[model samples]
Target: MSSEVVRFEASEEFARRMDAEDSLRSFREEFLFPVHDGEPAIYFVGNSLGLQPRKAKTYVLEALEDWEKLGVEGHFRGTRPWMPYHEMLTEQTARLVGAHPIEVVVMNTLSVNLHLMMVSFYQPTRERPKILMEAGAFPSDQYAVASQVRFHGYDPDKDILRLAPREGEETLRTEDILDTIERHGREIALVLLGNVNYLTGQAFDMAAITRAAHKQGCRVGFDLAHGAGNLQLSLHDDGPDFAVWCSYKYLNGGPGTLGGVFVHERHAHNKALPRFAGWWGHDKQTRFQMGPDFEPIPGAEGWLLSNPPIFQLAALRASLELFDRATMPALRRKSDRLTAYLEFLLDRLPPGVVRITTPRDPKQRGAQLSLRFSKDPRRLLEKLNSAGVHCDFRSPDIIRAAPAPLYNSFHDVYRFVGVLERHARD
Candidate 1:
């Protein structure tokens, strides 16, 4: 159902009716939700860890069986050869992020990829040594950027420029971001941001930020941990120099699974660009020759460090297959409606009971809604969890509930709000 056309109602029957009319509703059966009191709990924390795809077991066991049957030859002779296992994911991953196959690669975890990207893209000249990033970014990103600055013998406190929301504001304004880039473009070596802020659920305008940064001659990148599977991204068109994301969250690749990286096609063949390379990144033909010299692959694959864990690749392949079948455009359409429905229901609660910190504009947010309670937010979170609602709490009184469109229903949103409403009355 188109969000613009449907009139939302605050009733269970209405929620069920919307779910019944949903086109992607059947996709929910593909995942296994957690059980509480012998029924599927309201799993609304896909922003942290996605539910397991049923096919993940099949894919994982297939890889294990291949290893048992083929021994070391499994690398060369399996249903999906272990040696080239990562290749199976390339096309679907590229499609997920709206990048060309050459620009995307599945490799290390999010922080590792971020560090690797910085190694090549965060080159700090004597004049342009500062890194501009959003304040309160995911701690790992902040740490990585700081360490990189220190490695270059620059003081992080002086070289790192942190942009914060205006006083009394929960999210940063696009104009402010662009203006900051414009003002510090010369001193800034890179602009790194989490496209969707984890705590506030604010989705930045990536394309606009990219254009502004490029105009000022600064390298730009994003940490898309929350944006990846939740948002309809156009990394190639958006033209960020690089971007990285974890597969464990919205991507449903299991806990701590492999992450993905996108190095724009413009940077793909730049072999002269300094990078920490490994044998897996060498030309496949020459890799087995045990050559002393490293000849990196021509695209994103060149950044790969070592052979990937085959089991993780298999599990992620299962999820990526579903992503290919469902398509981001379809998922995004449902996501808009699901999130809107959730917002609509939450708004009906008595004012001052809870405040939503996420942007009300759908374009400025994703599926997750960050709720700030007027009092005892942690108590509310505990109450909600014990009541079989699965969500997460951040420090300083915020509970994040993400109704993932792929596996969540309007009924889930309705029930979640019912829980909140009942608890708020207490």
Candidate 2:
């Protein structure tokens, strides 16, 4: 091994032994490995930035080749024409999220789509203008909702209701969430929460929670940024009014790629909803008529504000193809086993220094486990980095490690644990 440094150590033999029996081990070959100073690093950060799929290069090159060969005609006439390009991705993405085709649209960035969905759905009234969300939400979402409240002429400090975990708890519980919804539903205009929390790998009960929120007449939406590729989420069956997710993370799309949105079909036909519109959202057939009368397509496409970034969508297509090959259910099975194995291995470590903050139940979390280190988390993360285990560190004290089923193996988890054990001892 070319060792610039060895901050922590794992037996290569154990790593290989685990890899030998891993059912998902072959998937590691499908991603382009990350190298530091010409040596491939152990990447455990799929929860943050997913490794590039092997097909990504081809997908992006095809788009570029089409652009070169067709010039301006590429918009409508080239191979995989830009027209209806997003549609090429929608069907597979819809399947992954368990949504109907008409209800899902692949477009826009995650936070932008959330804002767009809220623009139409979050109509605060005199008696019920407050919005409800979990505390410790991803920072971008917190900023978005706070800005949304201010934009609507409501004081966010007064109107934004945050549901925090009970005293001495690391994650929110289902019973508590239901209670909070019942208590604030009367005054709440909307409920928007993470499907799988980013900092803590907590997967909320979507169907039951949606029913509860709707019962109290509060509109509900989800920030599925961490949920989409990490779990088998059903946006349609679960009945959230809307949901949004980024493609870059577990979706394995390139960095800062465009994202997808789901607006339940019930709301798609409602032309009365307020929104920020653009020309691309106009009727496809009559769009070139150039008249100011905007007739929207009869689906989620109505909410789209602009033609998509072709290059970004190309990257997404590569990732989606891999998802199709592996399929969500099959991937979820591997995810459960992989995370369980990770947990089992972690359990073997001396407990007090590193306690798992994520739920023990398989159904309540995705492939990720948020391990909380009682000591200085940043310092631990630094040692982890120096050791070449690339899991992400969420601020204060959580290290979020995701054994992404698409490209991670049981051996990776095994190897990571060995390094972590050394870090703990030091």
Candidate 3:
């Protein structure tokens, strides 16, 4: 499953042959690609918002019909039983992230989940009252950590440590990160980071980072908004204290769908951990008793605040079913190849036009390849849009493209490169 450049060629015939050989080719038809100029789009932005699954409508409609027919009884009498609807997704979601059902739950959106996890995990003491995180984390993560520290009466400037890449470097080194953890060992109360950097598409070593943080007697958590479905995660084995992610990107759930959270099983029964409690988190047996005492359901379910939206869960379940069938291992095999093919073709473009910011090693990244150009990519992005190459432009000069293994093909990558090459030439 190595992405050896020697086996690649820069030709349409080569792309077509690769597509013909790809075992995942049929999955492409399972999604609905956007149309541009009366043709299917060359969609490569799955890292941002994945293409909608053709089955999403079917799933949504089922829930709608259930609601209409059963009314409030849908809670207990519907086909899937709305009262336990979130349970249907637990095992599958856990499998996707390599965790047990007891450790995973689908609940609030990504940021809210982050806040909930921190409430339990980020217990800053007077002796060790600092948070260490990568510099330039997504703004939402930055805001969450900043506000959390402020709520505890600590100044973010003094209490938050931002780890940046070395001078003249674009990505952080594992050694630098470890060294930072060691240097700030005593002061650090928590270590937080995005498992995969959204802008650069650089996937961090979560296991290594978690081990280092634990060695320093610090709690560690990760924002997996980009890494969840794109990377092969072993949350339980990796030993991160907690993790959070949204379902829209590589998970292919509809826009603004439910997010997920992971809590290490070790903390499952720690009733002393602080959390914002709600009725849904109460014990299932006593939840309807109108009891005065709040007894949380053990494990990740304890953090849930409200009954999940059935329709959103339905959409996500539709996408997760696809992942269950394709399986991460098989998807990773094609993802490596599709991304390698994309890299191969991008390399053939004229020099000094665009530079890859993502790590070159396949093991160090997922399906995305971020291109930094010499000038603003806005005009070129517009041209790509008109040409039916669906991708996105970040501020200033970077363009991000992800060849999602579930539905994207080598031909899509090839056509995308052809359009980008023409734009670069002009």
Candidate 4:
């Protein structure tokens, strides 16, 4: 279908009516929004900085109070203490990724966790030391991979392999990925890919990619920064060796928060595996003994470098509790409908004015829609910002807008589309 062919009157009044009837409408009131021109700004930036949950403050305050009262004894003294804090959240996060509690652990930031995972899984023999990743991975991940290869005394410029979309294709096809893995399997030590690409919102096929990599004796890992809370992950069934994700984007854990890393159960008992560790990763019983030698714990916790920030965990705990209520299936249903509605409205725009670059199939994407304006990208973004319709612009051409189902209603999307059409037309 063409942009000019679709019919829908996306207007403020229409949006308000939709909100009034939406089942998830009440959630919009729970998040803090940017104020522009003395009114709450439309927040389409959840893919970058998720809107803060009201309960986040309460959770952090409780942790603060615990710190104030318990002091040095706070490790086991408070209600949600320093001890066993991250473990408390493992089960819920595992459910989000469809894995066992032993397979998942919330730990350091995404890049850090990726580095730690690489230490264990990216063991490259001289014959097969090259690491394979997307061509335009988020800069942080690129840096982590390069630094890791360098740390191993290998030159990243020659050893790192990059996979780009085929000529003239904006997004990569699944067949190309499988072909690359099969062709280079023996020389490829690891395949680290994004579950949902950050720029194009193209969701990759995890199960197939894992299978192809495994067939060639190459281990696989995923950088799920955009996938974690937005899509249903078959982490256990797909069986990647390891994976990492940030909580702040879709998990609503707060800025620069700790994140999750998954180590498949098969690797859980591999005591011979190489790992960079900390006192927390030591046997909890022997940790306080302050021994000279380090014995690692089993599973994901064995990769921990230190105890995580409890304040961040507190926020994650509250957010995961909400997930337990909404469940992935319920949120996905709303995501599909709301995003389709947004696409329908945007398609009503003038021909060639706005293009929906995100995949059309509901099964191929998450909640985000990335748009390309044939006009000046910066001007279009500023125009929306001035109109009180908040959205984000990825440099060059694409603007990413996410109608988060947990707190975003159908009307918010309707209003955003209405504002976009008016501005793009005027």
Predictions in order: lDDT: 0.94, 0.86, 0.89, 0.86
Instruction: Give residue 401's error in model 1 in angstroms.
Output: 0.5
- Model 1, span 215-261: residue lDDT tens: 99999999999999999999999999999999999999999999999
lDDT of 4 at 168: 75
* Clash number for each model: 0, 0, 0, 0
The TM-score leader among the candidates is 1
Which run of 10 residues does model 2 get worst, by summed lDDT? Answer: 1-10
- Per-residue C-alpha lDDT of model 2 across residues 61-92, encoded as one tens digit per residue: 98899999998888888779998899999899
RMSD of each: 0.9, 5.0, 1.4, 3.3
Q: What residue runs in model 4 are displaced by over 4 Å at the alpha carbon?
A: 1-23, 36-39
* TM-score: model 3 vs. ground truth: 0.98
lDDT of 3 by residue, 202-306 (tens): 988999999989998999999999988898889999999899999999999989999999999999998999999999999999898999999999999999999
Misplaced by over 4 Å in model 2 are: 1-24, 36-40
Identify the runs in model 1 with alpha carbons over 4 angstroms from their true place: 2-4
Task: Output the number of the lDDT-best candidate.
Answer: 1
lDDT of 4 by residue, 1-426 (tens): 112322345676755665565566666677777787896777777889787888999989998998899887888887777898888898899899989988999999998899989999999889999898998788899999999899888889888988898887777888989999988899999999999989989899999999999999999999999999899888999999999999998889899998899999999989888888788889888998999998888888888878888999999888888877778777777677778888988887789888888889888899899999888878888999888877788866899999888888777787787788788766
Residue 77 alpha-carbon offset, candidate 3, angstroms? 1.4
